[model samples]
Target chain A: MKKQLQSLKRIGFTVGMTAALAASSLAQAEDKLKVGLMLPATGTFAALGTAITNGFKQYVAESGGKLGGREIEYFVVDDESDPAKATENANKLVKRDHVDVLVGTVHSGVALAMAKVAKESNTLFIVPNAGADELTGPLCSPNIFRTSFTNWQPGYAMGQVAAAKKAKNVVTLTWKYAAGLQSVDGFKEAFEKAGGKVVKEMTLPFPNVEFQAYLTEIASIKPDAVYVFFAGAGATKFVKDYVAAGLNKTIPLYAPGFLTDGTLEAMGDAGQGLLTTLHYADGIKNAKNDAFRLNYAKTYKSQPDVYAVQGYDAAQLLAAGLKAVNGDFSKRAEMVKAMEAAKIDSPRGAFTLSKAHNPVQDFYLRKSEGRDNKVLEISAKALADPARGCKM
Target chain B: MDFYSFLIQVLNSVQYGLLLFLVASGLTLVFGIMGIINLAHGAFYMVGAYMAFALSSLTGNLFTAILLGIPLSLVFGAFLEWALFSHLYKRDHLEQVLLTYGLILIFEELRSLLVDDEVHGVAIPDVFSASIALNDTLSYPVYRLVISAVCIVLAIGLYFLIQRTRLGMMIRAGSHDRDMVQSLGININLIYRTVFALGVTLAAFAGMLAAPISSVFPGMGGGVLIISFVIVVIGGIGSVWGALFAALLVGFADTFGKVLLPDFAGAIVYVLMAAVLLWRPEGIFKKG
Candidate 1:
């Protein structure tokens, strides 16, 4: 009688475990859309990653918590700001979790690594940032789509503008990194084509706080203008030091809008009258961008940066593609086709994909001025990205 | 190269070397006397810079800012020792390393929370902002020259204090034989605290001098900290004059390495360090 009771209990336990498994599968099938976000969430680039995550969240909330009628699930993994770690995380996201789509990564090198994995898996990779030109040039892949401008786009546009302004002698100070090298190179090429002479070229280290020696060198050079290629804290430091070095009155400093922002509000009047070029400034007068600016500020209680805007656009583009495929991720070719159509409304009027599947968009020239201690745009001009040999 | 241009570069190297000595000395002192490899020493330097920034902004006087910041840093050093570091005195080297590493994390996080990661840098004061023209073609910042002068004065003062004073005698003794001095009833704890505070003050003053030239931001201390550690090790860990000489060696190596082999600037220092260590494992100046 005891043996009979033990057999019955074992049967009951097995049935309960099977039932739980069936329930979980049913729940997952009904409401699953796994999306992966890989960014530098834990290292030096954490500040930018946090901003990207916030924007990603804002987009999900505004999309009614669903994409293509399926409950959206996102795995935001910290890549630790390393390219190798980014690749490792990408494997886990694709192989382990079986995420249908991937988005994110702000570093160009990290983005390139992920692009390789996405190509291997035949997964749709929506890059919201990472501006290396080679990603869309010789390194182009069919599985990747970028909503952000390429590394060369803004600098090339700025070069043309500087040439138009009839600037003669220009000095360039850029970080000693691949992205910095490409940006400065782009500027140099375009500026020379525009009939401007690059008098001096200097490369500063990343996250470098020291500028005095370089500034002293530039002072000695006494160029007609200085073009800066530094982003993040480097940008903040460059602007303050430029002004404080009292070069404001002596030499004109020109940089991309990535180097200046409402964050300059922290610098007070020190940020005033700095000239820059960019793809989009917060002061853009376009109706679509204007609305985005208002909604973003209302939601986050802070000004939306280029990273935030790119994040929002990446989500919208993914949603459009999913909608076109009728939520069928198994139809990978169809999804890729729909994404290549580039039908979403980006903040910068409209950014349609080029042959490389990278966005062919407008770049802007802007200047920073202050009112009520706020960094405000005092001037702007729009220009388009120059066509290059990039076949995807 | 022409003689004049060569002279200018040499001057640049020397000025940089002198500035490095200021920070490396403090590191050497703490490590030599206390046997605590304080990695967060660089964070104290950063704190000094921030203090100078705040005080300068508040008082609109450069001299006043330096004066206020040095004492504040000294007091902070004392507080840090009393609250946390003292407990690790009897522990092994690994514990001291972990605790100091934790301190670095806490300090960096606190700085980020307080100031945000956006860059913060102090500017050269108006009176000293002009560059001195070496010739019609070359000019150098007056501020760098001022930094070199200040470093020289401090170096002289430190030499006098260490060689001629009674406190210096006790510090030297403690570094060589802490247990023996303690048995002699020399109040070892008090001496350690004072020595640590002095070391911290020197590091902070270096930071204050550096702020006008470098960008001040979270994690800014990390680079300096590593370099100072290398300087301490290469100089025989706790040797003051060794630190000075090693610092100058490093400064020259860095400046010249960048000019000659820009791609290998990061590795040159380590390569030099390895060569030195291979020659003398206990360093140029050992405990004795």
Candidate 2:
């Protein structure tokens, strides 16, 4: 017992010393262009952030560790997918290290908070994964650019798909948050615009584990199709429960992209044939996408998702912006102009700036399937473009 | 509510309550009987989940993983009891809390190092993947029913072990007067070890079961740990049956609260705990 206490004490001392030394060393490196990547590095969203970081790092590596001929330095902080932590990390990046740009925020709620800090500091905020509509809508700012789709675009496209399939009655199940509600609202707008009735709209909270009761209610509604917007374990549990409710035979179930990959991995065979929409898919057969997929698979030993692809694009966009400015990053106006005029080729396709300063790219329809007892994308192809209902 | 909806809610409540019992039983025994306030009970739960995740992945069998995990958890609990908890048994609540509070950091950091920070999940068996039909329209996965049944059996076994057995009487007596049992020439240290091991095993078992339902990520146990403390408080400290009753009550309230009032569901549990404490300072059930 005495030996154990002594060992614990020694471990604590070593850890404390190591942390102190790392902090001091970090303080001395001042000339480099520091970019802070803030996301959930240690929580339920860790894998998502990790993949995004991998994408960011891949771009850096491919660029010979230099962006616009300047050696780049990256600082990644774990936000734990908490809004308060996002705000804290953003402040640290903006005020402490004085990072050249901030690229991150996976949760919509956290992204919204970080947007406020970006507005205050006038730093380039390149959001890659968070799908809150307000990031490019009402919350749109001169310094902010979203490389990912909003909660609206995918849901609206889903509505169009439902309309084409001639699904009359629809039931929408979403997490009761900004991102979740926006997803349902987007689908509702697109579906109703195409003359369809929304039978039920269920708003569940984030991190909800069980869905048996809600499934019972939705099954009773007997809608033609069920549109869901859940992420993480919630998505996995929902898919399992959807199958348990036997809704797949009675009513078709559809969701956005995030519901399929990590969630599907968790759900395993239960998630087979689950359809979702996105801008990028691992199964896309394009030259650029295939190359990116091959490179990502070779490097990470896992297929890259849209979030990772967007994060890579974000790094590339920053590089393009820096190049456009003739590498003169001292002037915000010059950099902003360069960023605005920049066009880049993405895994999705060639993306250019919209009036809102967000990306205008193609969307894909994907279905989850198991090939040879391992989960893989079965169907993936461009289906729609982000347009209408936004004058920004 | 419709019959199908009502039945599902009942199932949700039962499953949740059973999970709470698993954590609270360990906690209440340590606190009520031993008079030690442990904030690190949740950390053990976290350890259990991560252990199950790693072991199950390695062995490719849940039963083997559980067999290995429970002993590891017991050893961990015993180590904690010897290195930290036993020292504070004679000390006041403040010191016990401060020491156990430090244990939380130790446990969390250790778990983080051992298990990479990722939002992964434990896979359920193939047979349990399908739902059992309660009726024509209402059905749930067989895994959940299995979880409920396992919890109930464990709860019954624990009740019998603690109440009916000779060892149970000694533990009950030790809870009240540790030195008195020591004076009677009983190996009080061995008794302490047994009780501590039993407490931790319950928490780890809960973690193993819950791993499939939720994302088995870092810091996952913190949330459940706090709720279990609430269960221990609401049920009455050191009372195993009280822990069981309170676990179910809290579970039902939390599940139904979420469905009926989504916003206040989490807040309502703490509110109920405070209200119950106000009504009966010790808890809903007193230690007999």
Candidate 3:
């Protein structure tokens, strides 16, 4: 009886394999759009990745379960925010899954690895969150487009905006990383050019949360303003600690939008009136934004944050490219051109792609008001990355 | 830095040192007493922080949340000891490390599934949220001061328990000769289980107390775990007093390093550890 049962199970497995193989060719003829989501699905950046995925899926739903009149199938891989596994994961998407396009990533290091894979595979990749300047500046590719702001852009904008606000002497604090270094460099350049002085710079190693000693230093130095770069939990702690230290009252605290992005929920009243610069803001009054916001909140059951805007715009960018090529992705050049020239009327604002394929968008000077980024004004308009050293 | 600034940093160092002691105490206990190298100790801390976050929200009171969190943590720790570590008492260090490392992964995945990866803040109770003004411009958070005070009380209590109590006597005897202790009919298994559970509870309690200032999140455990291991090693494994002294040394070194050499702050702690090792190869408090 056992032998017969084993034989019967073997026969069932063979029949199922035959059915799936037979259907493969039939399904291929339909030519569904394959999108690979290589975001960090379960780590420090998991919430950011979740927002990006949500925005991407919401657009697909809004577009009647299709992008560019083609049914889309998604292959999602959690990048785990480990730079070592990033290329391996991207290779799986490009080689193993043969995905038509790749959408990813939150960590700058991991995203850089993904960019390398995109370059080698010539696979169209949309960056939803990571803002490494090198992706557009030195290693810009015709195949890559970023819906997010570059690391330098918003920081530079913040520097200028703060300078205009009469914060002539600012002290900067952040974790030491490519993103942090580049952001501080960008801020210093603009701030000094606007006749400001950076008294001193202090940076701890990346992912370190203890900031009390540094807070003491800042209090002692007593800079006119504090410009910091922190994200997620670090940002939450820094804001809370900074305020608790009583520095915010005397030394106006400023940072790139990362200090507030997706962190307002955790920050609570601690972030109120905290001015920040970012490519997206809450009070961007427009029909396009209204529709996107309504749909996103309705779908996700929460207010859409900046990260979600980037993800939604990523989907919009992809849809535009697919539509321009009439969903014939085989016309790779035309699709790439379409994506490169794509003008996105994002929830943030109307942003067009630069020659380097990074977003040439307005940076909004926003003030955090009761769990919302109230748009004060445009800090910088139509800011385009220099894309220095890029042949493109 | 001015005198006032230096004074503030000193306070920062002490506050940080006390918190480190709270975390490393439990790590040293299990390593010193139970003869088990449990890398999953940090996972217990992370879970405690997570539990505090959840219960604080559900109970709407930080004190009440902690009241519920401790026993729950104790029970969880006891369960882990009974189910897993009890069998690993005689296992080699490498096997114990590998097993506990696997447990860390399991606990992290379990946490992620249950809580997702959102950073949650535990609002300090009103009583502890107040600030003590050091000067016109410099003020310290009351929560931090409270943390230092609580850790002092804990250290004294832990010292008296280990030195004066019957369980402490048994634990000391077992650490010296487990087989002899067993032969003496002292239920060595129960002692191991109790010590292991107490260590876990202490680590979790540290996490709970820290949630307000640290702001609970994923991967927070890993950082504390590394620092705790450093404390255990430098203080001599299984020596609570060594853990305390080493923790304060690291805390002061780290705080001063960050202020003096922000760029090299990350390496300074390890440098101090290396220097200490060069002086005393087996740690400052290692016995025999």
Candidate 4:
């Protein structure tokens, strides 16, 4: 028994020494700025995550394969849209790889976890896509920067558009979660202010696609318009069911940008004439979008959507920050300040960062046009998210 | 809700329950007769949807795609039975679950490789695309009604096949005593394979039929798979009638819950399952 214990202790010591040696060797071998991506590699947000990666890579390549003349290396961990496993995945990149800047995440729940980890470690965090309002609201931090729209920004714009169209009674529907609640709250804030009555509010548990009962209820309620907040497969199913139930003819449907993005390709003709609000849209009549879209298609063999644009802008923000610090990164405060101050000539529009680090950008009022978005109106230009409940 | 709208909600519940019944029927049959927990059952459903998507694009007809897809599903199911599931028959339930789960992973990966994991909608045949006006303000979809009718006919056919046929007698007997049936000189192995293959075919058909309404996407099968298992457990395992009744009970509970109790809609299905488990640990129906 004594001999066995000694051998076990010796084995444990050798294993620990080997791990330390390997980690040290890895650090000695790489002299590049480490960028870690923790994004959903599969499930509901996989395509968005892929687009973000592609967009980021496209920006890096355009900047001569370096950000501010510093070579950047990447490590990726799949968040899988699972909030429970999110901290572990982010920590693997933050502590193990010791990445200088962590870019992530499409699901808001997972993003919340990533933001928490970034806050604890003081790691520079650039959000590529998730849009829970709390990220910029009460949970806002100096080290956390978002290149995406808040859940409120687009929803608020949709409310303004609905009010302008003379909608008196509207029904709001969404899943029950941070993103869904914030979206409805934002819409309600603007719609009620515009003298519209929210007749009824309905929500399903998050990630559940059973919308039949709700569809029947909507028909009975007979609202002037339905303001829905759903994305990915849920969005696809809702649009189809809505049309099938013949509610689309009598009542108009409005949603935030995510309801239509890549989902239009799947929804086909059912998606036509649907009005949504977002920061980015296709056919924006700008040289920046032209180049971004063309090169994105040429490289990835698919047209880039709003998610890709957010991803490209994330790299753009990082590049701007690096340029400000002359790539030294040790001046952490200055790096963040530079990032906050930088003006981005994005595919969406010319935009700058807000005090809370979320984008202050134009919201495009877009109509779905044959598997693409045609910009109809600019709902709010250089619009800053209210980011209510934020102490920062 | 008004009476007319309540009626519409009832239709919705029935339609949802019928879809569940189609998938759960196969799951219960395979579990009852073969005594194997097939987690890859959902993968077969996904395969059917993908098959319809692929063949519809090729043939330019949804009905024709489904017809061609059925044989392919049967062949694939039979191949699975021969290559992998056959060995798992006598193994422990954990081994069966693990092997089937592994199959689900492989199936998902292959689907991703082929279809790029994006949502794709199937067009409902134009003939069934019209709606029945419920009142001046509302209407019910014709395709949903047609789906329900077809499911009813299929249910009747399944009932007749099981209760009034030689094959069903052997299946029922095998469910009760596999070793005894084998000892009685019936090729019980052949019956198990047939039952397994038929179960796969039923699930695949449900997927094909549901494609137009649900919109096929990656990870689409996971939710239905979980729900189907709940149904199988709450209904007696291997009892088709039990699955049908339990599915309807779940469907009504879920539909009513969503309309009446929106916050707890997702939990209501499981709540019903738990209540049933508490009352009858073996399930709502007794084993044959």
Predicted candidate 2 versus true structure: per-residue lDDT over A1-392, tens digit per residue: 99999999999999999999978877775546778898777756777888888888888888888787777888777877888677887898888878888988788888988899998998889998888787878778778887877887778777877887799999887777788888888888888989998987776555555565567667666788889987765677677667765667668887777687666556766688877876766566768777887889999998787778888888888888887666667877888777778877787777777666677666666777762122233232333224444454
- In model 4, the runs with Cα more than 4 Å from the true position are A1-31
lDDT of each: 0.76, 0.77, 0.89, 0.89
Which stretches of model 2 miss by more than 4 angstroms? A1-34, A75-80, A297-303, A371-392, B92-112, B119-123, B126-130
Model 1 lDDT tens row, A1-392: 99999999999999999999988975775557888988876656777777677776677777798776667888778877688677888998888777878887888888888888898998778888888777777767777888887777777777777787788999988878887777777788889997899987777556444555566566667788888887655677677667655666678887776777544644545677666776666556678777777778898898777788788888887877788878877777887788888566777657777767777676666667662222233222333344355554
- How well is each residue in B1-288 modelled by candidate 2, as lDDT tens digits? 677677777877887788678778888877787777878788778778788888999999777899999888889788877776777767899998898788778877777677765456688867677777755655677887788888888889888988999999899989888889999999888888788877877778788887777657666667777777888889888888889999899878877776677667547788889999999999988976
Candidate 3 chain A weakest ten by summed lDDT: A22-31
Worst 10 residues of 2 chain A by lDDT: A371-380
| Candidate 4 residue-wise lDDT, B16-109, digit = tens | 8988888788898888768889898899888888888888889988899999998888888888898899898778999999999998899899
TM-score of 4: 0.96
How large is the interface RMSD of candidate 3? 1.2
Model 1 alpha-carbon miss at residue A25, Å? 6.5
How far does residue B30 in candidate 2 sit from its true spot (Å)? 2.1
RMSD to native for every prediction? 4.3, 6.8, 3.1, 2.4
Task: Please report the candidate that would top DockQ against the real structure.
Answer: 4
> Looking at every candidate separately, what fraction of the true A–B Cα contacts under 8 Å does it contain?
0.06, 0.33, 0.69, 0.80
User: How far off is each candidate at the interface, as Cα RMSD in Å?
Assistant: 4.2, 3.0, 1.2, 1.3
Chain A TM-score for each of the predictions: 0.86, 0.86, 0.92, 0.93
Assess the local accuracy of residue A63 in candidate 3 as a C-alpha lDDT between 0 and 100: 91
Interface RMSD of 2: 3.0
